[model samples]
Target chain A: MKLHVHIKKKISEFSLAVDLEMTDGLLSLLGPSGCGKTMTLKCIAGIENPDEGFIKLGDRVLFDSRKKICLPPQKRRVGYMFQDYALFPHMTVRQNVLAGMGRRPDPASADPFLERFRIADLHDRLPEELSGGQKQRVAMARIAAQDPDVILMDEPFSAMDTMLKWELEQEMLETLSEAEKPVLFVSHDLDEVYRMGGNICCMKDGKTGNIISNEEFFEDLKNGNSELLPGWRILPPER
Target chain B: MNDMVNFLSGLDWSPLFISLKTGVVATVISFFLGIFAARKVVKASPGVRAVADGILTLPMVLPPTVAGFFLLLIFSARRPLGSALYTSFGIKVVQTWLGCIIAATVIAFPLMYRNARAAFEQVDVNLVYAARTLGMSETRIFWRVIMPCAAPGIVSGTILTFARALGEYGATAMLAGNIPGKTGTISQKIAMVIQNGDYRTAGFWVAVILIIAFLIILLMNVVTARHMKNIHRY
Candidate 1:
């Protein structure tokens, strides 16, 4: 599956104009904060409306400005894992995970993720009751349960300790890898990016300036094509 | 003095019952309307919000006599509503206890709305967002997330409305009139007793009212204190 997006939005002073196409698997929007990375993902998820842009995940035109076609976030079927995970505190882990289940709620799609994420035992626990790692797992299961066409993550592990982050990072990659659809994840850690294993898109000044393969990503960073963009970053390198 | 004592002592309690009947009904009615109006304001478009906020507060700011006049305008026999209530429904407002209730509700409504709106506004809308993301519809999210969190606010507004209704004077006297044992309220009762140079009777009723209002206020304070705690935690 492929998702195409061309978004232009002015957020206060800096304007973001993002035009990028991804052909399935995992695509990383590698950028620091305020680099328009999150907005690009939000445009695809139908959260924030861009000034002028269109996004299409296959035949579904999620957002088309000229036609004034804008599907709300609920209808987009693009699972978003907010930087904080945005899990519902009032709901038990099971209920949160169940949110993304099959429309018919066939146990077939959900049971496996719950079991895989190892949160099957924490089903009754509220979000506050769960540990940081458990919350991260529940987020994964919530996203996995829905059978979304695309999963979008914004700094998924930003709040956790490095160990917890690394631990959840592996779990996320494993679960997201199981689905056949595309996953567009955002991250600042160069190492986590390397661990996640995807084509990297380095964003700068509201534009995505580079889309380099893994080898090229590292080489450009070491050799300094990475320097062209100010505030450019190298995510935590893979161990 | 003995006759006055007997008249005050055996004052038929049915008027007290009727007064309570009006106070309670008025308070309940205003509470519901106020909550609805406040929720609408908080959730409304900017233009609608300004209009609703202003309209809701009119009862609070307008003279209770003005409210009586407006109610008279709205429900007088010559007016459409008055004509309908009198002719079509055979209902009456002038010198009627229900008219007192209507008058009381209008005056107390803004307190209910303002308090409830503050409570609702304090709620973190992110919780609502999180609920929606869990695939729950907006209504479900509201019932499950918004209302439970706003309960204390609702309760506080209810108590304030009840207290306001209990003390309502100008609109109740102006619209419903002080027909003893009929449209007359506790306030009217106290005023009439005092006018007749019945200080002992007035003092007795005043003491009794103080006890009752004090208890109610204490209960209201307890609820509000609990609500404040909830606001801090939630």
Candidate 2:
């Protein structure tokens, strides 16, 4: 399936303009904070509105400014992993996992997701009781339960420490690759882009300044000249 | 025999039972109305907010007797709505069990509105957005997530309302009057017994009500503690 987005909006604080034609695989939107990365992701997920845009998920015209067609988030098939994971504090992990599924409580799908996350034992625990990693696992399970066409994650790994971030990053890559689905994940970390990646778009001034395949992205970074980059705050050690 | 005599004599059994029933029913009705009013007020435009804010806070400021006069006017046969509710419906609110409830509800509205409003506001806007993203309809989100998360605040608000209803005196006495078998509540009973110089009976029931009120306040404190504990850990 192919997904394309060309959106423009003028808000009070800032404005956003992005154009992307995407297919199946993880595509990390790399940008510094306040670059409107999250907002762009929200627009694609149908959580926010863009002033003008054309967004097509495969043959489905989700949004087209000229035609003035916009789909709300619910109608759009999008799996979102929020920054805090946003697990319902009141619901047990099991209940949270089963939230998207309708009435009468289906255990058939829930059991496998709990097993996949290795959170079967944590089914009874609330979000507060779980560690950061555990919460992410539950969040992932919730997304899997939703079973959307495109998975959109905004800073999902930022809450973890370095070692844990790397470990989780690896797991996310392996998982997404096996699924082979279109994804748009946002992060400020370069190494994370390197680890869990397909294509990279470095954003600046509300637009992507650089778009390249993974090999070219890593080689360009290895050359140690970041002026070609959009908004790279950290430079790697010499050589 | 003396202990049994004291135990039996100590109870103003009728008023005690009436007060409990009145307090519960009043709190429940007002809690629902308060939630509805507060939600309506919050959704109203800024201009409407000021008007509703003033109107909502008005019942609290006026003396209970003044408020009673207002209700008197409200339920008076002159008014079309009041006549319909009382005459056509066979629902006699003046000097009846329902009038006591109506009085208590008016006083309890502010507590319910303030608490329920604040509880509902504490819900993270982001979480609600997330729920919408998950394909959950607005109604489902409210009952499933919003209400459950705000349960502690709702419970605290309910306790306050119950306490307020239990202690209601001025409006109830002025409006419903001291009909001992039907309309006389704990507070009205206390006022009547004192007037009659039945210090023994008045003092006895006063002590019972004081204990009940104190325990309710204490239970409210416990609810506050539990709410804090549950709210903070997340």
Candidate 3:
């Protein structure tokens, strides 16, 4: 499935103008904080409205400013995992997964998702009881349950410790490969983006750069091409 | 001790019951309406929200008697709404128990609305976005996520509303009047007894008020403390 997005929004700090397209693999949006990486994902997911824009996913017009059409997040068929995981504090892991399916208390349906994410044993536990990594698993399971056309994850590992982040990153890479859909992963860390190893869309000052292959992205970084990525400065050699 | 017992036996307890019934009915009505209003106002456009917030909170800021006067203007039997109700439904609010409920609800509703609004504002907005992305309907998200997160403030709001309703006097006195068995409340009873130079009876009523207020505050603290622990767990 293909996803196309061209949106413009006025933020208090800057005017966001994004134009991008993706299909059938993870496309990492790399940028420093406040560079509209999250805002672009929000626009595609229909969480935030754009002043004028068009977003199409697999021939479905999610948003078209000229047509005055804007799908609500519920109708966008786009799964989102927040930076904080955003697990419902009051619900158990099972309920959070079931919520994605929009089904009743049917353990049969929810069990597969929990099992898939390896969180089946923690089904009855509330989000507060889960470790950060477990919560990420539950969030992933919830998204997988929805089976949306596109998945948008905003800095999913930002809250985890470095050790846990590495562990989760390995698991996430496996999951994304199997997802086989347009996945927009937002992250500010160059190392994390490099590890993700996909098309990199660099953003700076609310504007998106060219979509470069992972090899080219790392190549440019290694060459100290800070012009392509803002908020990047090669460290001085040790004294 | 005997004199105290005799005085208790002679006490007219109708005022206590009436006040409690009024408080409960008003509080129940306010609880739903307040939450509903808070939700609406929270989702409304900024300009509309500002104006709506001001109007909703006006009764809490205004004098109770002034609020009662406005209630009188709307439901005074001579007014259009009051006349229609009287003619079509045979309902009379002025000088009736209904007057007591309306006055109390008007005076106390803001507490519920304000508290609920503040709580709703404090909710992590990303949770709502997450729910929406999960394909949950708006209603489901509201009930499942927003309500639970805002429960502590709502609980406190409910207790404050009930207490304020129970202690409502000026508006009740102005609209419902001190009808001995119909609309008379504890505060009006205490006032009437004290004005008649019955210091002992008035003091007893004062003690009852103090006890009820204390119990309500205690209940609030217990609930909030438990809620705080739950929040910290998150």
Best by lDDT: 3
The model with the greatest DockQ is: 3
- What TM-score does chain A of each model score against the native chain A? 0.90, 0.92, 0.95
Judge candidate 1 against the unseen true structure and give its global Cα lDDT, from 0 to 1: 0.79
Restricted to chain B, the TM-score per model reads 0.90, 0.89, 0.96
Of 1 and 2, the candidate ranking higher by TM-score: 2
Model 1, residue A54: displacement in angstroms?
A: 1.9
Choose 1 or 3, whichever is better by lDDT.
3
Candidate 1 has which clashing residue pairs, if any?
Answer: A100-A145, A100-A146, A189-A235, A189-A236, A190-A235, A190-A236, A191-A235, A191-A236, A191-A237
Q: lDDT by residue for model 2 over A1-239, one digit each (tens)?
A: 78888999888878898988778998888888988899888898888889997888888888888998988877887888899988898889998898866565676668888998789999989998899999999988888887888888999988789999988888777778876678888888788888886898878768875567878777766675453363533456673
Candidate 1: TM-score? 0.81
Candidate 2 ranges beyond 4 A from true positions: A65-68, A218-236, B1-12, B42-47, B78-80, B84-91, B221-234
lDDT of 2 at B76: 62
lDDT per residue for candidate 3 within A124-214, as digits (tens), equals 9999888899999999999999899999999999988889999999999999899999999999988798888899998989999889899
TM-score of model number 2: 0.90
Shift in Å, residue A134, candidate 2: 0.7
TM-score of chain B of 1: 0.90
lDDT by residue for model 1 over B69-180, one digit each (tens)? 9998998888898999898789999888878899989998898989989989988765565454445667666776788778878887788788788878888888898988
What would the per-residue lDDT of candidate 3 be over residues B1-234, giving only the tens digit for each residue? 998799888878999899999999999999999999999999999999999999999999999999989999999888999999999999999999999999999999999999999999999999999988888888888888999999989999999999999999999999899999999999999999899998988898899999999999999999899877756563
Query: How do the residues A97-189 of candidate 1 rate in per-residue lDDT, one tens digit apiece?
Result: 776563446544566777988988887887777788888888878877766788888888778898887878787777777777788888877
Q: lDDT ranking from best to worst? A: 3, 2, 1
Q: Interface RMSD for candidate number 2? A: 1.3
Model 1, residue B83: displacement in angstroms? 4.2
